[model samples]
Target chain A: MIEAHQISVKIGAQFLLQGVSLKILPGEVVAVIGPNGAGKSTLLKVLSGEWVPSDGEVWMAGRPLRTWSILERARRRAVLPQDSTLAFPFTALEVVLMGRTPHCKDLERACDYEIARTALIAVGALHLEARLYPTLSGGERQRVQLARVLAQIGDTFSIHPCYLLLDEPIARLDLIHQYSTLQIVRDFARAGVGVLLILHDLNLVAQYADRIALLKSGRLIAEGSPWDVLTPEVIQSAFAMSVVVIPHPYLGCPLVIPSPGPDLVPNSVDLIGRCKEKK
Target chain B: MGTPAYVLTVKSLPRRRRSISVLTILVILLMAIVLASVGIGVVRISPGQIFAILVKQVGISLSRPFEEQQEVVLVAIRLPRGILGILVGAGLAVSGAAMQALFRNPLADPGLIGVSSGAALAAVSIIVLGTKLFGGLFHALGFFTLPVIAFIGGLGTTLAVYKLSHFEGRIQVTTTLLAGIAINTLAGAGIGLLTYMTTDVQLRSITFWNLGSLGGTTWTTVGVVAPFILAAIIFILQLSRPFNVLLLGEAEAEHLGVPVEPFKRRVVILVAMMVGAAVSMTGMIGFVGLIVPHLLRLMIGPDHRYLLPGSALLGPCLLLTADLIARTLIAPAELPLGIVTAFVGAPFFLWLLLQDRRRGKFL
Candidate 1:
């Protein structure tokens, strides 16, 4: 399990995140949803050990994440930052192979092409096979980055359970790739892997995430399953906008319809999550 | 189904692990340059005689009896200085190459970063001040003053650059460049101020320092700078993988488990040791550092495994060639090696820039 205790992150004098505590168990795909400045990325940075929290610390597995070497952290977990750009003309395969950095034997180079090939297959980037990564579109790049992260997870791991933390992973991918990406994460969750994704598409979050951790202005306002967290009142309170929450036509998870209104917000969720006093 | 299927077919065929072929080539080239550099000075000595004299000194003669006068010319005068030139050149090139990678910037050069200016300052201070302090001691120690003071000055400036230019874990390339430029300009003006205060002979010394001649690079000068440069090269060659990780940007490099902060600090110091020593011996030779690794990268790839040693060998070769031309072009008058490099390298830089524009990409 991965968990944070009393985590607080202050950028300059402003508290971007404060006194937040959460634990994610195995087989959990928790989606964190928030408005633009709600610190979703900041929370992910803290979670992924990319940014150290000002007040508290994070524990991965059972030990402090800080105690683990960088290679150990990399072997156990992988991160996909939002704006991962491919600046080189390295082949897609070569790029996927980079994910094997932490575990590539001899500390020199990689041998098995199968791992990278398989990652490409897993992410469905195979036909773009010999294509230069710099030539790929933004969505294609995102999928390739995910494949690279997956390759890292697959190669560096030693059966201690792997976690994937993605920051706004699907925002640029096309719908089909987006659905496939979520499906792969769901399948991984089912296989007992831990996955935390920051998502803006609430409908997909409602459908795919096993639990939703609603955050607003750096504070976790609500946490629960789709049925519990996606109530119209909760959506209105979290986003400060009215949303018609109805059953999905097929999955019956809550479907989101933005009502684009103002007064529907509860005065309390904001006063609490906004003020962000110690609980 | 809409996902590009080709994206999944990653590089699976077993390719040759990027090996040490680059190192082997550099080694072979170094030996060849060592042989060639010995024969290239203004006094035309045959390659045969160069080696014969070199061997006789080692107590193994191959051909004719070693001529005392010729051996004196080869071993004592020309040979040591040539070796010094190559050492300083290769060391500065490697330092510049490593610094470029360490800072993750393309435009970095040994001369631009105050290493050369630092050496120049040391050289000038000695000429300006040593004459008084050492008295007739000046005549006995005049030869040593330039190298020692230049090295100390280079070291001081290097530390200043390190402190002023680092912020958090990042090397502010722009700030470093500006700081180096600012320091260099100030140092140059200080040179001018020192120039104003000195005698005619000291003014000539300052003027000559600015032009960057390889005139007095004797065996002892080579002896002083060679070990530092050689040690720095070995250290830098070991850092190629870290340089590779660094090319991916600091955040990404750290994610790949490279301790970016400490490694960058080490790189700057290594660079200082190399360039500080080199510039102390040779005045401000240019472009070997900026030009060689870049050309090598285009010929091979951006992989520093090839680039570092390639720069090392190529840098010395280019410097020796420039030095040879400097000697032969005007005969005894001798154009400065710095001028030769600017003449050769500026055209090449323009061509590369034009090529980048044709490809329409930012390097």
Candidate 2:
């Protein structure tokens, strides 16, 4: 499990993240959803050991995060940033194989290559293996980067329960790729890897996320199962926009639809009044 | 989960046969260049006589006899010079490849660290003020004084750049480049001032040194430079994997288990040492490091595992070929080695840039 306990990040006088505590346990998918400037990426950075919090502490597997050597932490955790800017002529396979650096003793083994190929296959990027990374489309590059992070964890070769932290992994992906990528994360979680994702689309988050942590103004407004956190009152408070939450006919989850805008939607004022009363 | 099983389907990757073939070809080319370079000097020796003389040095008596003068010239004059060319070439080329990796910029070269300008500044200072500056000590050091002083200047400038760019715990790439720019300009001004102070004979030596040469190559100079260059090349060759990972940016490399800061620090120091040692001996040989690695990357791709070694081998070949032309094209009055390289390299590099632009793959 990866736990961020009362972590707050401060840059000068501003607090990017304030007293945000969260946990990603084994065999679970925790999605962090927020409006723009809600400090979702900063929280992810703190959790992934990229930034040290100004207050409180982070723990992974019952030990303080700082105690883990870089190698040991790398073996147990993998982070996929929002975007990776690799401007080299490396083939996709070569890019994927770089993830095996921490695992290999000296040179990468045949098994590591197999792991890399399997990762590409898992992310539906197998066909891109021979293509140069720089030549790939943006969506294709995202998938290849996803494959790289997956290859880094290599769950089949690791004995320890690992954590995967993704900051907007599906931002550039199409609808089909977005679902497929989330599904892949869901599968990894089901296979006992803890997955923490920062996502924008709430409807997809409603369907795939076991739990959702909603943030507003660098503060977590709500954290619970999708049903509890996706309520009209909670969504209205967090986004400052009226959203009608209704149960999906096909899926067993709440579906969120935003009421256009204050001037455009005639009923949005009424919905906001009702949400205020509930709040 | 207990070891999530994978049903392997993809075939294993092909072995590194291409890299092996490339290295093999380079080794063969280097051998031919070395032989041709050694045989083409003022006293021309046939390939057969050269082979006989070389074998005879190892206690083998060949049926073909060679002249004593030929053996004397070959062993004393040409052999050490050829070896020096190989060492300096390999050193500069490998250093270039490593610097490009560290900077993650294709245009980065050994000169970016202020080595060339600093060495030039030091060499010019010595030429203009050696006797006055050091009195009897400069004369006592004799042939060793200039190269040693130049090496210290190069190393000192590199360290200053490193110190200036290093902030808190991280090495800033932009700051390092800026620092290098600042140091190079300062060194250039120093060189200019010193050049102004020189007399007629002093000015001639300064000009010749600035143009670069292998004219004074001797066994002693080769022996002094051999260990530093060899150590640096071998060290860089072992870092191909780390270098490849580094191309993915610093944070990504760290996430992949590379200690990025220390790794970068080590590479910078070693490259400085490598380039410093070579520039001290040959003054300033250009283009080998910048062009060789870029050309090899185009042929074999940017896998440093192959690129580094390929550069190490091909660097010497180009340098030896250039040195041969430098001495021969102008006859008894030698053309400076640096001029020949620039005359060939500038056009070729521009053509490469045009090709990259046409392919829409400018680096």
Candidate 3:
């Protein structure tokens, strides 16, 4: 489990994250949802130990985050940044193999190669192993990155429950890929790994995330299950827009639909009829 | 997760095998070039005589006695100069590769970034002002003073450029390039001013230094610079793994258990040391660093594990070849080594750029 206790980050008199406390338990998916400049990425960085917290402390597996060596922390957690740009043309297999850096002394070991291949297979990108990374599409790149992170924490030598901290993993993916990616994360969570993701889509979060932490301007506004966090009042207050929260007809999860603004027409049927009458 | 329908294609395995073979070929080619370089000079030594001399020097008595003039030419003049060429070439190329990886750009070279010029300026200053400034102490220090001073200047300029380009924990590439340009210009101006103050003899030496030559290499100079280059190469080779990780970017590298700041510091220091040592000894040989690693990368991909060692081997080979051409192209009149390298390197670099542009891979 990963825990952040009253974490606050300040950069040149700007508060990037303020008094944010959260926990990611094994076998659970926690989604952080917020508006622009809500410090979602900053919070992920702090949690992943990429950025040190100015005020509070973070603990991973009962030890202070700072106490663990980088390699040890890396073995226990993997971070997926929003966008990872590569200047060199490395193959997909090579990119995945980079994740196994901290695990082995010799990079050329056959076991490491096997693990990397397994990771690529797991992400359904086995065919892309020989393909150059730059040639891959955006969605394919995202999957490849996912495979890399999976390989990072999937060391066969260690049996620790790893935590994955992802920043908008599905931000650029299409509909099917979005669901499949979340399903992959869910499968990892089900296998007792904690997954924390920063998400923009409310319905996706409602569908996959076991709990949602809603933030506005670097402060947590609400934290609970989707039903408890996705109320109309909470949505309106956090997002500065009115949204209707209803139950999904089949999945029994919350479905969020945005209500039109005061000046905008609400019904598409009425607009079409008005156009017909004018003709 | 579903099982992948496609079998795990031995994609990386073939590349690995090919890379190993390529490295072997490169090493063999470097050895051939070294032997060829040792044989061809103003006084041409036969390949058999060169071999006989080499074996005899190593305490192996050959059956046939070698001629005294051939022995002197091979052992005294050409050998030390050839070894120095190899050291300078390898050092510059390895440093160039490290700098390119550090900056995450292929175009970054020690010379382009003012490091070589910085060393040259310091060496020139010592040559021109050593007698006036330190008097007896400079003479007492003897041959060690130039390299020491040049190393300090090179390391100082590199650190300054690094500090200027780095803000917070991130290296800004544009800032680095701009800082490199500014430092290069400033160093060039300093060198020009030093040139203005020198006497006729000093001026001629300064011109030779600026053009870069291997004419003045001695065994003593070779012995002194070898250890620095060796240490730098070993240090850089060990860093190949971290350098590979760093290609993922600073933050990502840190997350992957790399101590990014310390790694960057070590890389910068080592690169400065290697480049400094080379520049102090050989004046300022350009483009060997810029060209070798790049060509190797295009051949063997960007895996630093292979790239670093590949550069080390190929660096010496290219330099030895260039030095051979410089010595032999005009027969009795030897061309400046740096001019030959630039003549070959500049057009190749332009070709690389044009190729990248045509492929729409412009940075």
For model 2, how does the per-residue alpha-carbon lDDT over A1-279 read when each residue is reduced to its tens digit?
999999998989999999999999988999999999999999988887878899989999999998887778888888888877776689999899988888886567888888898888888898899899989999999999899899998853247788889999999999899999999999889888899999999998999999899888788889999999999988887877888888998997999988857564568778889989998
TM-score of every candidate relative to the true structure: 0.86, 0.90, 0.94
Candidate 3 C-alpha lDDT tens digits along B1-363:
234465544444666777788899998998889889988876777777888888998898777667888899888888999899889988999999999899888878898788898889888988889889856756776777777788888998898888998897778777887898899899889989999998999998898878888887889999889988999999899888889888888888887888888889899889888988898888888888889889988888888988998899899999999999998999888899989998998898788779778868754
**Candidate 1 vs candidate 2: which has greater TM-score?**
2
Residue A154 in model 2: shift from native, Å?
Answer: 1.2
Candidate 2, residues B13-114: lDDT per residue as tens digits?
443567778889999999999989999978998889999999999999899878999999999999999999999999989988998888776766767667
Report the lDDT of model 1 for residue A8: 94
Worst 10 residues of 3 chain A by lDDT: A152-161
**Residue pairs that clash (backbone atoms under 3 angstroms), model 3:** none
Give me the runs in candidate 1 sitting further than 4 Å from their true place: A85-92, A105-112, A126-136, A261-279, B1-33, B64-69, B130-176, B350-363
lDDT of 1 by residue, B1-363 (tens): 123335333332332233255556767877776666666655556778887887787899786654577787788878886788778778877877786786566667777777778878877777787757656655665655555567668777876876788886566777888888987998888888888889998787677677666776677788777777898889888877767666656766667666777887678767877876777667777777888877666555556666777788878877887877887788778887788988887787678768767878654
In angstroms, what RMSD does candidate 3 have relative to the true structure? 4.3
Model 2 root mean square deviation, Cα atoms: 5.7
In the predicted model 2, the residue pairs found to clash are: none
What lDDT score is found at residue A251 in candidate 2?
93
Q: TM-score of candidate 1 restricted to chain B?
A: 0.84
What's model 2's TM-score?
0.90
